[model samples]
Target: MTETLLLIGILALFGVGLYGMMILHNFIKLVIALQILTKTAVLAFVIAGEMNGQIQLGQSLALTVIVADTMVAVVGLALAVQVRRHFGTLDIRALSTLKR
Candidate 1:
């Protein structure tokens, strides 16, 4: 029962993240949406490991995912900063329009 609820929650989080990614035009918002999607995947992996009685494996994988996500976030922010420096805005549409 609890596992089912967790799965449902994960699905909801994925849906929200997908929606945010599709509807938001700002680079920062897209980054946040990606983070949310990453979290949903982490949660699903943890829940599956728990159900299979592989807690340690799940934890280690989750930790690895956290590290990878952190690295991705850092790189993404650096790129965003560079984009802002060169373009003066984080709006995706505006940036696209600048391409002549």
Candidate 2:
């Protein structure tokens, strides 16, 4: 029963992340949406490992994912900052229409 609730929670989180990704246009918001999606994956991994009696492996993988996700967030935020500085806006559609 608890696992089922956890699974439902995970699904709800994933749905929220997906909705953010689809509806948001700002670079920073997009990065946050991506982070939300990544967290859902990490949770799923840990839960699956617990179910299979491989908690250590699952935890290690989740740690690795967290590390990678942090790097990605840093890079993404850096890019967003640069884009804002250059274009004076964070909207992805606005950036797309720029000319060299």
Candidate 3:
């Protein structure tokens, strides 16, 4: 079924994004991974509801998630900028090393 395939794709994207988040050392990379993971989760919710013929709750939740994700992305970018400024690099390891 298309629904099943959609679910699987969503799960794959979520896992891949998390993996990227874990392996990436750059602040920007982490932010991008977080965003991708979140959007995939949101997509899963919406897709699942559509498949089940009950879309109201999913749509409402997705709307809220979109708003939250937007705010989080803005804040995250600001934090990244600050990190770049303080350390002159976006690499988290380098930032940590600078503390010594």
- For model 2 the local lDDT of residue 58 reads 95
TM-score of 1: 0.90
Q: Residue 34 in model 1: shift from native, Å?
A: 0.7
- Residue-by-residue lDDT tens digits, candidate 3, 6-82: 88899899999999999999898898999998899789779867977889988888888888988888998999999
lDDT of candidate 1 over 59-98, digit per residue (tens): 8898888888888888888878888899999887867765
Judged by whole-model lDDT over C-alpha atoms, candidate 3 comes out at 0.88
Q: TM-score of every model?
A: 0.90, 0.93, 0.89
Judging by lDDT, tell me the better candidate of 2 and 3: 2
Clashes of each: 0, 0, 0
Selected candidate, larger TM-score, 1 vs 3: 1
Candidate ranking (TM-score, best to worst): 2, 1, 3
**What does each candidate score in C-alpha RMSD?**
1.7, 1.8, 1.9
List of clashing residue pairs for candidate 2 = none
Q: Which numbered prediction scores highest in TM-score against the true structure?
A: 2
Which residue pairs collide, candidate 3? none
Off by over 4 Å in 1: 97-99
Lowest summed lDDT across 10 adjacent residues in model 2 is found at 91-100
